[model samples]
Target: MIDGAAKSRKAQVHRMRRIFLFTLLSTFAISAQNKEKPTVQATPAPYEWPAEKDKKYQISSTFGESRIDHFHNGIDLPGEGSKVLAPKDGRVLYRINSEFTPGEMPYGGGNTLILDHGDGSNATWSGYMHLKTFADAVIKNAPIAKGEKLGTSGNTGHSGGPHLHFFIYHPGERAMLNPLLFLNDLYYRDTKPPEAKEWGVLLADKFANVNPDKPFRLSADYPVYIFLQDHGVGKERWGVFEYKVRLDEKEVISTKFDRIFFKEGAWSLATGHKFEDIFYRNLYALTPQVRRAKKVSVEAKDLKGNAFSKTFELKIQQN
Candidate 1:
């Protein structure tokens, strides 16, 4: 006795239920596989700390924070005058004698060494700065192993005290990554959040200007990196923060960070591969102007109503 429209509606509802059941099963299967894998990967430790000493040290500073002029680019491993070891077996690519300084911080990857691991991954051009001296004849291109003697830690080149200024670099990215995650095999405790810092908008250009009239396009090749710091009630917080890139108050790009979890306290935006842009010549440019406004703005909001923003004022300078 049902009409044609009712029959169509019933069919549509059945189809939707089928889709919902399929999606639920797929999600459960993926979750089960993930749970079976090691919570930590089984990569070999890069080096051995001398005498089984404590790998525990307070982080003195971080990479990519707003520096006096440039950006700090690596995590500083607190040594407390402890000897620094290689994190993995790598061939010595290059070594720098000078240490890093806040005045010339980014350049102070002091006594640095690059290692080629033959695999797709490479060590973070391990830099042991503030050192008294190398472990004797540890020269460039020398074969080095994990736990092998590199050098004693010291306060050198822009260093505050005796500690190892550790820096890890991915193969081709201009940005450095968090080494603490890669070193999960080590005995360090990580109840703290990854340090959230370097609060600034990724502009459409090198000038830090975004066009409001035009839609701001983030390169999908190289991901836009954001330094996220906690500014809320501690563990009581359990919600996602939303980020949107807009021009002239019109929402262009929007998303929520429900999956980006915090551990040991810090969070980084590197995992969001959806926004990475790499191949374009204008890595970031405020364009596609619709003649509405001349400038554009970017806004970020945490679920708790905490927000940070940056506005790019347009310019017409000729090259």
Candidate 2:
């Protein structure tokens, strides 16, 4: 007769194998769902551009652009002494004045203004940063009209140069939304697709050293990184709006830069949510157990629907 203890141990091993296989299958199913297109829950009201009608301005930076420490929270219109206007009807909520002082650090967004539209449940706030000063008639708790002059752009308060930092805030969630969604197509034009500068796998603390033109061996699993940027009509380097990663032709991660929020404070620039957490929905971390494919690909797109894609071959390193 067979030993009872040995039979029991064998059964346990079988059960554990089944559990592991089920988990792996479930993970792939979830990843496939994340590849679906995202939908916006709340559509914002129409708003006019905040720049002067007759003059032209260049976009210095686009929303969701990655910076050295933090992602750019708003679009930048670079111009010296450019007129800043209210995009919609709202009430001036707050204003700041940080006069330039040599050898002294001023406020983060030197000379700022916030306007509140609607009330209670539907309230939304529009923010203007790096202003030279508030408009002469603008006052606290005063109503502002659509297309009204609000201020002039300047290089004040921790700014590199003169520009208008514009953004929209959803009060209900306390998150920053991409203002490009609410603006008209006539405001700006971009026809070129985003470019993928580099793509590689992260090994431990650093990227695997391999020539990109040749096939690289990946001994261990690691997260992937894609350096992408957009180009506008003027050939300005800007930020892309969306990106996706695929493994062996199966999509693993799909993300769009639509909104962002701070985790620690209400609006601390330095400490905010991780890039993957806010934008990605599946296979975000790329743990060792999840890296089983030999082919990897990445795609990036700009706000105007221009897209770019590239694929790379990955081989499992032999011991």
Candidate 3:
């Protein structure tokens, strides 16, 4: 009887040990998974430029601003009044009819359609702003194919002549994502480095006591956008004045503009991977704590080596 009791105790201890080990492993696994899931949809899906060959257009402004007070909420594809197409396989969320009398600066974004991809991710919209009308088959809750015609481009909304203002949005957060990364043939890159428009100590936008002479270390959590204003038109050098972005004067990002063929006026632009909203938290290891009330300076230079500097102060906080 004593032997049996001892044996039973031993088995119970062994089972308990196994259970404890399993729970420990499970906890560790869950932690690893949490660290691995990306904040943004890094996975490239089947997305093509939403325009046909004869589509007369160019991409204008992009997501994230080099300036303050306004951040681009979406990618702007210059439609020069071309028929806009669906970005990918998705459902129409809504179609908004618009009026053009607002005197909005760049027109053609009127008569827009929103698309829901059902992935907690949706294109808040896609449409030929200032369009003549929807395609014959287009209707609310209708399915759209990639590159299918939705409407004929027209001069509507706030516009500069006839052009389509193509845009893409992260529906939930309403953040504008660079549509170029999602599109296959709709980008420009060149081997030559972009012209150096300027380089300076980047600071938080809201610095009331901005010290331009001081090399303020960028707040470790804040990512900086190097705004180049001198990107020229059709200069083969991406018409870009050129630029270099450095953290502590160490080159982290730099580029030369690749000049496009027709839209010499079209600007070539790019951003630092470390500076995106989705990755700002990850950048904490790289910068200083930029207080909300601070300003960063840029020492910009033109093609002729003419140098000018500007300071932009903005309102930022640790969210």
lDDT of all predictions: 0.42, 0.65, 0.42
lDDT tens digits, residue span 57-135, model 2: 6787888775432456679999878889999999987776766434443245678788887655456678887798678
Q: Positional deviation of 186 in candidate 3, in angstroms?
A: 5.3
List, residue by residue over 89-127, the lDDT tens digit for candidate 1: 777765666633234433333454445443542223344
Question: Number of clashes in every candidate structure?
Answer: 32, 0, 39
If ranked by TM-score, best first, what sequence of candidates would result?
Answer: 2, 3, 1
**Which window of 10 residues has the lowest lDDT sum in candidate 2?**
278-287
Write one digit per residue (lDDT tens) for candidate 3, span 201-244: 33465322223244444444543433244332334322223333
* lDDT value, candidate 2, whole model: 0.65
| TM-score attained by model 2 | 0.75
Candidate 1 minimal-lDDT segment of 10 residues: 277-286
